[model samples]
Target: MQIGITMFATDYAIPPQELAVEAEQRGYESLWFPEHSHIPTSRRSPWPGGPDLPKWYYDTYDPFLALSAAAVVTKTIRLGTGVCLVVQRDPIYCAKEVATLDRLSDGRFLFGIGGGWNAEEMEDHGTVFATRFKLMRERIEAMKEIWARSKPKYAGDLVKFDEMMQWPKPVQKPHPPIIVGGGFPHGARRAIAYSDGWMPIGGRGGDTLAMLPPFRQLLKEAGRPESEVPITIFGVGMDGDALKRARDAGVSRVVFGVPPEARDKVLPLLDKGAALMRDA
Candidate 1:
């Protein structure tokens, strides 16, 4: 299984470019930065991870910009948006950004996306809470059309655009791999429907290892092969046994979270993770 690292990419953390270079030198396969345009101060929606939202969530830099910095600095490590909230973004501009980054990275880009949880946050972006899922789907479809066609037009209920001309198409044919992030059945179903991969948070509902068989069965039910929608679990711990278990379960990738911190603090953890990856 491929091992990767993800960070919130805050102003105070080891900068994304430095981290990307370091991760690549250490033999990590990919480097991911998560997106959160802005966190609302209302605190109306509960965080799934815990009661209080972490400070880094409020301070994260734009994932595309951060990953662009990473892309320019590293040649081999694949860059990814850990979970870009497409529901909150304009698909046209987003398609341009994705294509630019993919071109800059020479086809080494992974598009990890999701329908985010923050209701007030989505509302601030002119997206409704209850229907955000549908909106996300439409936006993704629209982006796909933009990437695949020179003068693409899309007319979905939530997202619509006339045959717009855009340049710098993505280097990856049919665009970069779209990896949907969320918990199973719903998330897995969405991935099977539109995306190329599934990424569930580790320790969210139950063991991700336990969900593998059922997810594959769901893929079969949808007439999609397991190879078409590989699994990538995020927030994995640095445990050799767990890594082996994930590899045994046929997981394509496992991403470990690096806290937003200084280089002195983060490098040791990366070193430890690299050692574990060697053993894994």
Candidate 2:
């Protein structure tokens, strides 16, 4: 199993490049960053994690920019968007960002994505909350065309475009791995339908271990090999037994969350995580 770290890059936190170098030196396999363009102050959409939404959601930097900074400074450690909100973005520009980042990182980009939960935030981007998942599927389909073909054209219910050329195709064979992030049957079905992998938060919906068998069964029912659609559990804290269970259960990767803080506050946590990685 692979071990990784994730943080919300913010104005006051440890700089992303510096954190990337630290993670790489400590032997972490990948680094992830989450994105939020702007939080709607209306507080209409309750945060899934808790009653009080953290400040990072409102203050986080763009994932592409933060990951790009990480990519240039690290040679081996992979860079990823923990979950880029594709539903709120234009596919053309988003595709270019993914491709450019992959090229810059020498094919080390992992595109973790999701249809986000903030209804008011999506409304600001002119996306209807109810149809966001459908829109996400179409946008990702359109982006895949942009990455793979010389002159890509897409005609879908929500997204339509004429044949047009985009530069800087991804360094990965067709494109970087698109890892769909969410929970249970719906997220797994989406992964089987289009994405390369599935990422479920460790304790959000249910215990990841409890969900693994059914997830694999769903993959089998869809005729997808278990190896093809790997499972990545995010926000797995430093639990040796849990790590062992995840590895034994055939989890492809486990990512631990790093609090958005200064170097002094973050490095010790990385040290503890690194030690856990060694043990796992």
Candidate 3:
């Protein structure tokens, strides 16, 4: 299985280009950047990770701009958003950004998307918390249509657009891989329905690898091949046994979580990670 890295790029953390260059030189397969456009201070919506959210969540650099910088510095490493909040953005403009990034990166782009967790944050973007998942799905579908057609039009319950022309169609055929991120079954179903892949947080609530068999069963039920909807488990621990188990369970990629820290602190971990892989 391929190993990738995900980091929340911030002012105090290692810069995107430096990380990307180092990651590529170390033989890592890809680099993922997470984003939180703006965090509301209301504290009404609970943080998903724990009782207190990390400061970096509110300090994240824009994923598109960071990844674009990464793309310029590295050639082989694939660039991805760990989970872009599609429910909180305009699909038409987002589609153009995706295509431009893909073209500039020589077709190496992975579009990881999520419905978002913060209720207040979604509300700030003018999206209702109750219908965010539906809106996310509609946005994904609409973006796909935009990428694939010269003059595309889509009409969904949450998202609608008239036929319009857009330039710089993605270098990848049709579009980049859309990896939907969430918990099992539901995310798997959404992925099978429209997206190119599924990404579940590693060891969240339970071992997501255990859910793969049932997920595959769902794929069979939908008449889709197992290979099409690959799993990309995020926040993975650096353990050989766990990696082996994930591979056996048919996971295509495991994205290791990197702490957002200064260069001196972060570089050693990156070097050690590369060394560990070499030793393995």
CA lDDT of each candidate? 0.92, 0.93, 0.89
- Give model 1's TM-score versus the native structure: 0.99
Candidate with better lDDT, 1 vs 2: 2
- Count clashing pairs, candidate 3: 0
Evaluated at residue 121, the lDDT of candidate 1 is: 92
Model 3 local distance difference test score: 0.89
- Candidate 3, 82-130: lDDT as tens digits: 9899988999999999999999899999999999899999998999999
**Ten-residue stretch with the least lDDT total in model 2:** 235-244
What does candidate 2 score on TM? 0.99
Candidate 2: C-alpha RMSD to true structure equals 0.7
lDDT of 1 by residue, 1-280 (tens): 8999998898899999999999999999999988888888999999999998998898999999999999998899999999999998889999999999999999999999999999999999999999999999999999999999989999989888788899889999999999999998899889999999999998897878898889998998999988889899997778888888998889999999889999999999999999989998
Residues 236-280 of candidate 2 have per-residue lDDT tens digits of: 788888889999999999999989999999999999999988887
Clashing pairs in 2: none
